[model samples]
Target: MGRFIALMILVIPAVIAGYGIKLMRDTIFTLLNTPYPNLSVQFIAGFILFLAGLGFIGGFIFHRDKKNGKIAPRFKRRK
Candidate 1:
């Protein structure tokens, strides 16, 4: 189905991004000899994930619905 394909396309990038961020965080923590991640780093990483999810998931879902004409136009004037 188109929805499944769209979901996969959107999800793959976010998953890759999440994995890449985790790898980077681990590398930095190891190099810096930090036992725990900084709060700011944690917040930034979470924010990035949030944005990725919002953008991709929201975009695909909206696109699919719009493609099917499920979304109605707003603010139409009465005839």
Candidate 2:
């Protein structure tokens, strides 16, 4: 059950990241999404979404690693 929950958390962010990529790609090809008024807005929103999702995933992994003592000495929490 714990593993499933963890997987679910990871999957949601991955889907967000994928959608962000799609948005950026569509904007580049001049296929504007109706929700966004212009290419620039679409691209910017995509960029934010991509970074946010990626950051959340990265942070999750980093926290797990730190908890498992797999992080480098420089990154380990000060005792």
Candidate 3:
């Protein structure tokens, strides 16, 4: 049950980010003939989603690995 919820949390943002990338790609191709290609909110939203999703996944990995001692603590000073 917990794992399912965790997977859902990771997947939802990834799906949103993927949709955003598709929207931006289509917008760019459709506007390729225009003299001045302008960016729409969809592009910005997609970028944000992509970054947020990456961050979430990275953090989850770090947390999980740290628990198993496979990775060092993020804030600990290595001497």
Go through the candidates in order and give each one's C-alpha lDDT.
Answer: 0.64, 0.93, 0.70
| Poorest stretch of ten by lDDT in candidate 3 | 30-39
Alpha-carbon deviation at 9 in model 1, angstroms:
1.8
Total clashes for model 3 = 0
What's the CA error at residue 66 for candidate 3, in Å? 1.5
Candidate 3, 19-48: lDDT as tens digits: 667666856775432332455765666577
**Error in Å for residue 74 of model 1:** 2.2
Residue pairs that clash (backbone atoms under 3 angstroms), model 1: none
Off by over 4 Å in 2: none
What's model 1's lDDT at 62? 79
Best by TM-score: 2
- Model 1 misplaced stretches (Cα beyond 4 Å): 1-4, 13-37, 75-79
- Cα TM-score per model: 0.51, 0.96, 0.66
What is the C-alpha lDDT profile of model 2 across 1-79, one tens digit per residue? 9999999999999899989999999988999988999999999999999998999999999999988899899996688
> Cα lDDT for residue 28, model 1?
55
